[model samples]
Target: MYLRTLYKYKKWLFWLVTIVIVIQGIIFLKQGAVATPFFNYGMYSEKIPYLDNYPVYKIYANGKLLQGNDFSIQGWDRIYVPLLKFEGKDTVNAEMIDIRNRLLYKLRLGSLDRKNAHFENPDFDDQDFYSWYRQYLSCVTGVSVNDLLIVKQDYQWNGSRLLPGDSLVIWPTIP
Candidate 1:
């Protein structure tokens, strides 16, 4: 009787085992490719194999980023992000920018009027850059998502961050 029951369910068991094997195979394939960089290293192009899904399309025209979204050029690539004009208040954070741009965008957040990016403490520095930056950033408190923000690197207040109103000019020198 037990043998008959086992045989009766043999087909179901076979398919179940096959499904599990297929899943394992896919996981293994992804793991094998885990060594690859998501931003796509080694010259920006589809010529590289198995790296097509890299999120950033890293626009290149005349061998430079002309305009781009959800992409990053390799190395110290430079971009002259047009001055992001502000229409209202906004809050800038790492997660929000990362999701918007599809990259881990880091920000130093300071005023274009300031010269540094450090939010200094008398104990930390003679001045606080973030505080100066907040004077501008805090405008986000009651503003719409369509506000503007002049972003810069964590130290260089020359403009590196991007907000909604800012039209990012993709054409810039590649680092």
Candidate 2:
């Protein structure tokens, strides 16, 4: 009788365990997303030395300015910047592809372009890349990928200012 009862409850127990596991996974994955880290080493090239010199910016969250080098972000609000609504359109071609590759190679070391001269990231999915590029250029500060829709165009891309420019580089430091 006891074994029969236990067997009858097996399905419920399995579902309960599955739900708990999924919840745990979500929590762990979210923590990792919020704490994504990057190194600010002395890369060979520097268009803007703003990051190289400053190396660190205080983390801002929910209108709060935080200390330390650890930048935690989540959802759209996690990204704080002057949102620039990109609505213009552009064309995608070999020349345009090369432009972005060059920009990436220049700003970031170990860029995809550096691996092979003709190497283009096959994963560049913005089919209408020209529009994407236009939007990026329009941004003066930072942009959140989740907010890249016309219905919700907020124009304050703080991350844009975090890039390397022709004459300056700024770096972040951990406190």
Candidate 3:
């Protein structure tokens, strides 16, 4: 009875399966060219490069160190995400330019003449960011941020645990 029902709808089933396989094949072929969700199965299979030093951002609000555990996941993201973006702005811009050039080349369009092709933010003031971040932090954490200190500390992973190394004050520079 089940086999008869399946045979009756065999044409429909065949067409559906063919469509799905074709879509998957297209996604597999264009995996590196574009970011097709879930189709790039090898994305995480690539070995990650081992780095001796890993930099961590430590934020001190009102003279007290803010711990990650103290805040909710989203709250912690709010705290550190901006810092990461600000610190890695140049690297991010370079990556974006590379992606843009690759996409343009793939589409048969020539790459940008200017290497730095308006990607860099000229008006991004450090002092302005610091001031705005201070206010934003206060609002996000619900604590008055009188003094904000952001430090980048490098740590080395020794098999099991992380060993702390040199620290650099990123914000409120000490002259």
Per-candidate clash tally: 23, 41, 0
For candidate 1, the 10 contiguous residues with the lowest summed lDDT are 81-90
Looking at model 2, report the run of 10 residues with the lowest lDDT sum. 82-91
Local error of candidate 3 at residue 57 (angstroms): 0.8
Estimated TM-score per prediction? 0.16, 0.16, 0.69
Query: Which number leads on TM-score?
Result: 3
Residue 11, candidate 3: how far off, in angstroms? Answer: 12
lDDT of 3 by residue, 55-165 (tens): 999999998999999989998999989889888775347677778777777887754526564667666677878898999999998988999999999999998999999
lDDT (C-alpha, whole model) for all candidates: 0.33, 0.39, 0.81
Assess candidate 3 and give its lDDT.
Answer: 0.81
- Rank order by lDDT, top first? 3, 2, 1
lDDT tens per residue, model 2, 28-92: 65542222232233356447533333322222222344332334443222322312221121222
What is the C-alpha local distance difference test score of candidate 1? Answer: 0.33
Candidate 1 C-alpha lDDT tens digits along 20-63: 65666665556432222222233454474442122222323224
Give the per-residue Cα lDDT of candidate 1 at 84.
26
